[model samples]
Target: MTKDSVAAVLERLSRLYPKNIDLSLDRMFELLKKLGNPQDDLPPVIHIAGTNGKGSTLAFIRAFLEKSGKSAHVYTSPHLVKFNERIVIGGKQISDKQLLDCLLQVEDANDGAPLTFFEATTAAAFLAFSAYPADFVLLETGMGGRLDATNVVKKTVLTLIASLSMDHEDFLGHTLAQIAAEKAAIFKKGAVALSQKQLPEAQKVLETYANDRGVTLKSEGKDWKIFISKEGFYFNDTLFPHPALKGVHQYANAALAIAAVKELNSKWLANVTDSQIAAGLIDVVWPGRMQPLKDFPLPEGWELWADGGHNPGAAKALADFLPEWNDKPLHIVCGMLTTKDSENFLKQLAPFADSIHTVPVLNALHPGRSPADLAKIAESSGFRNIKIEDNISHALADLTAGRYAPGRILICGSLYLLGDFFSSNKGVKNDRQ
Candidate 1:
């Protein structure tokens, strides 16, 4: 957890670019070119972009492919614990030695010029991925898709866009169409593009983008689908267990992973049987989303959970799923970045909580929204019994000290907050269904 070579490099890169995001591919392209364009040398890639569910979708895809006896290299952003968490080689995270070498190479390649942390590290991931031998690679965009660091891959075998919603509005345009268009730009003309059922506004833009390129996107409820039945999860008519990840919202994401696997027809996955697909849905491991916190110190008889749901779309998903908790009194300890639409996000989660405590994300470079500021928004959003706490420990202490009754605790709002939480709590990984 301490600052290692990889962390040191990341720390320097943070100073090179503003802590705030500057979304574009220009810096990424330049850095990758200096690094010999390792992106092109990577194995057949399945690139994914979206406002939410990008990580979970990748997890399901990785599980399905691995279950089918395939090895894949995965690249995703905002690592919860370590920088090594971002790059996986043949199912294992890159070793510290390899990660440090990659970072050194990427840093030297930049030649002291400015580059954002994500862009520079993306180059390092591609470099490591290209050097490693693997059957496939799963690449997830860091932010918006079009100019994102991962979008440098011109012709992926499959491109996926998961749930889209209003997020990073300052960088991506404010409207849904604008965000959808940015995500659509990652689509390769010859690739089989698939998406979860999008809202009308977002779907229109996606369909228009597909039509303009003459590519028929296989969409949920149109080309393929999945649902939970009495038997279990059903894709078309096949009965499979529920997705390894929790929450009803994951059914669509699992289906999206299945759809992406379908495009693997040109590769080893083409011959994969339905049974393997069913097993994959039952054996995926995604650490942060709805992850139960155990083996950590907590109040007596109180269960804890953590989610990295930062935007309105993610907030709505948590809101929808909480009602099914079978009457557990939900107490949320929340923190969010300053850039997020706190008012809107709070509006969605406020209705589901019994008591809400606002806490500052102490370690974030961009800093969390002030607890007082967040409290005002929560109060206005009709959140019951709001209080401001200095940090997660303080919030938990308040609950433990009889400020609130024992209940189910949810630590949410930002991935950065969860990153800090996991460093100390180090919760057990979720069990595969």
Candidate 2:
């Protein structure tokens, strides 16, 4: 159980930097130098970079490897409930004592130098992983890959790129090709790279980057592909178990993870069999991405679901899956960060939802779009019935009391918003979690 130690460290770290994202590797490299470069001492690492699906793909890789009897140290960013969720040591969340001690050590090593929150926490994770025994390290880039703090590692055995789209346009370039180029920077000269299926424009940019870097990239739809059926998923004619993730898009993400495991030339996985990969298909758990809420305080007649997909591509993916909910009324309680394209995101979901209730996300990192602002955005996107609520409890109360049949409810937008849901409704399983 985590205590005030975790909270106190996070508060101090956040105060070290004014802004959240300052994308560069110099600070991370300097800190690692002072700490004797723990990143170089870790086991073989699988670096993952993309706009979306990176986290789920990393989860699949961990599940696949762990099922094959390999221990892994996994790192991801933008925690849902607690900061501890970002760092997984030896297949478990770092203990409260372990996390706080590592953070304090890194903080002291910094000696009043400037480091972003992500950079500092990631250093702590690397240090912990280096000291511990693990066969692999699964690292996910926090944002755009080229200058992400996590990219400072000295050795990355394999790199995987998931689906890319226009996100973080302010930091990364505005165009899809530019964003693809930035993600491709995660590819090192001696490391192997595997990419998910990309749009033609994005694919062209990645191809150029690969050729320029003199690295060969094995991409989906070429080097490998998957055939999805109701029974299970087939990769290269060998069938694996069904993907436990909620969205149909998960089939594609699972295929990429499977491809990486199959393609990696590592002694650690030299004896891994197909049956382990099949078992791993049903083992991975990534919350807030099309996760269903089981025991939240809802009326007996209603069903609730939550997803933390915040970008236009994520919105498109959510729109594609929401249709399968079938026949029943689907109402959405949505909140979004001010940095997101709210109108375009709601434009995709507007056609499916019976009504949309806008709420402000309670996080201050990025002040969320006000409910009034979000309501107008929803209204412009062909949403006929739009309501603004101050908080999620009132939204749920009004929704339950309103004139509607037995139906499903979707709470979406930022992961911070979903974090609020998790905090308010504790002890509820976010399905497969």
Candidate 3:
């Protein structure tokens, strides 16, 4: 099958279910059973769950394994540009023909039962992974971990919980502790559990859960720490050059990846030389997470960065990175779905941004807050310079033409918005392309 054909099949599958995300394991387990229980046949799996940083952590692990000459399968969510980006088999994206064939097989097995798009896609990914051979499989949970479709796997070599925060209030929970407990449900007995630094309440909840399950908890600042310097990050007393990915948060994610590698302690991984680890750390790449668009169709001397940070915790991280820009008069273009905490997100970002441009997300699963509504939220959050735009291009144009000096523009908020930008600017080439 061609790429277009594969996309068509995926679109059909997406329409089969009315809801985009229905976090439950029963339907997924039944579907997997009908598909011949492929999830049980995967390689040593490393499951990652968190409000943010999961995808970047997965990228780091994949790069590390690949640099060591080992094969890995990776599954991530909310593709930036292509649907196929969600599944990586043996260090390469599953080919269009392979994805289409696997989707058809899954559909045949489901017998037309109602299943969310994420559930069906996850089932298809497991089917493809089971068919292929690899040393490790890195899986990122779609939402909260416990009932997430990806949580059905009975056993995993390593499970990582990245920096947890308050997100997905309606589906997961309203408070940090509640949400942390939902994510902590992925901790299987005897699995090596690694966690990033969390809020006090979240940390306590996760610690209690890990203790009860007898999972070895290798935590940041306790079992391992990362020191950032002018040269790069120092992980476990080993210095590495600046990661290939940008942003300070990346150092934390890299540290978590290194911790996971150490916990695996496999002979194949033990054979990895320091040079391999350094090279992999410097080579990792994950899109729409602090991704810079320096070479896009934008004007010269103007910098554009994109991130899919929709929650307050992510907003705080983005704010922390803003000071590094050094009074460049930052312009923020944001679009968010209605389910997100728009007021809190804007409150966290208001102090650092010179101006805010609110736009609507394209093909958003839930009702998208209009640009005007979002601008109002920003204004209520103490931002004076807020404007509503019809779309990202208009927002970019206004930001570039406005009084702000030749500073940087940050396009952020929802991953769905990033996908829309990618679709509209398909012909605009970038260095990564």
List ranges where model 2 is wrong by over 4 Å: 1-4, 18-22, 265-270, 430-433
Per-residue C-alpha lDDT of model 1 across residues 1-433, encoded as one tens digit per residue: 4345767877877778745456667788888888898998988889899999999999998888888888899998787877788889999988988988888888889988878778888888898999988888999999888898889986488889899999988888999999999999888877778999999999999999999997668789988877787667877776788776888889989989887887795444455567888888877888779987876677787888899998899988998898887567788899998988888888887777888999988677577899999999899988978989988988888887876667888999988898887776655453322
Poorest 10 consecutive residues by lDDT, candidate 3: 424-433
Superposed by TM-score, candidate 1 places the C-alpha of residue 172 at a distance from the truth, in angstroms, of 1.0
- lDDT per residue as tens, model 3, 1-433: 3345776777778778845555667788888888889999999889999998999898888888788888888899878777888998998888888888999888788777777889889999999999999998999999999899899886588889998998888888888999999999999886889999888899999999999988878789888888898988798788988988777888888889888877766523445666877899877888788888765676657888898889988888887777888757788899999999998888988888888999998787678888989998999998898888999998888877745678788899898898888878876432221
What value does the lDDT take at residue 272 in candidate 1? 57
Strongest candidate by TM-score: 2
2 or 3, greater by lDDT: 2
Give TM per candidate: 0.94, 0.96, 0.94
Name the runs in model 1 displaced over 4 angstroms: 1-4, 18-23, 266-269, 402-404, 426-433
Once superposed on the true structure, which residue ranges of model 3 sit more than 4 Å away at CA? 1-4, 18-23, 266-270, 427-433
Error in Å for residue 267 of model 3:
7.0
Lowest summed lDDT window (length 10), candidate 1: 424-433
Ranking by lDDT: 2, 3, 1
TM-score of 3: 0.94
Worst 10 residues of 2 by lDDT: 263-272
Could you tell me how far off, in angstroms, the CA of residue 51 lies in candidate 1 after the best superposition?
Answer: 0.7
Which scores greater on lDDT, model 1 or model 2? 2
